[model samples]
Target: MKDIEVNELKERLDNNEEFVFIDVREEYEYEDDNLGAWNIPLAQLPYKLKELESHIDEEIVIHCRTGARSGNAKQFLENKGFKKVRNVLGGIVAYRNLEEEE
Candidate 1:
């Protein structure tokens, strides 16, 4: 269970890196702000696991409002045998802070 800083995640996004990026926040939270990640909503992750089956062995990055939810999501995915699961440190809050810093 590796953790990725928001800076590295932003660089990857800028470079068009290919990976499974998931936002585990609820729909309303996502609608307010997001990184264009696939919205899986932590509560519904179990039901949507199949949708992510193909990416089980790939790099999967998960984030939430403040990283707590995404941390749980990362643990859950790893427990389910996902080979590479990374949680964005500080989640979107840090991500936005990075944006503001620039």
Candidate 2:
């Protein structure tokens, strides 16, 4: 699976690049903070696959609190035939840290 760093993702967003961003963390975690991504927790991924079928060929970024869960999500989407799935390295934690640093 491909890995995307927080800085790179921020740059892409700043550039207004089109991509599907999915947050694989729990609802409460996302409620606290997020990257304005679609909330589809890891446990709900399988059942929600259909909702993302049209994005199978699009650039899709998956993230959780940390990279682990999103790594799994990347693999799962790949297995399901997604062509451009990427896991946000260090996930939201790193993203937030980068924001703080900036």
Candidate 3:
């Protein structure tokens, strides 16, 4: 999976570029905080693959609580032939810190 820095993702969003940001954390974790990503818990990803079919050719960024789950999700999507997939290197925690710094 490609590694994307949180700052880069933030800049993309700020520029109004459209891309799919996926949060692979649990419902509670997602509710607590997210980078405005589409919430799809990792456990349900396989069954919900169809939901993201439209994004198969687009840039898709997957992230979880820390990054492990997102890595797995990235691999899954790659295996399934999703061309452009990225895993945020440090997840929301890192993004939050970067935001504060900026």
> Per model, how many backbone clashes are there?
0, 0, 0
TM-score of every candidate relative to the true structure: 0.97, 0.96, 0.93
lDDT of candidate 3 over 1-101, digit per residue (tens)? 46898899889978988888899999999989877899999999999889888889999999987788999999999999998999998888888888999
Model 2 bad stretches (over 4 Å)? none
lDDT of 2 by residue, 1-102 (tens): 468999999999889899999999999999999889999999999999889998988999999998999999999999999989999999999998998999
Native-to-model Cα distance after best TM-score fit, residue 4 in candidate 2, in Å: 0.5
- lDDT values for all models: 0.94, 0.93, 0.89
For model 1, the stretches where C-alpha displacement exceeds 4 angstroms are none
Better of 2 and 3 by lDDT: 2
How much lDDT does candidate 2 score? 0.93
- Alpha-carbon shift of residue 25 in model 2 (angstroms): 0.4
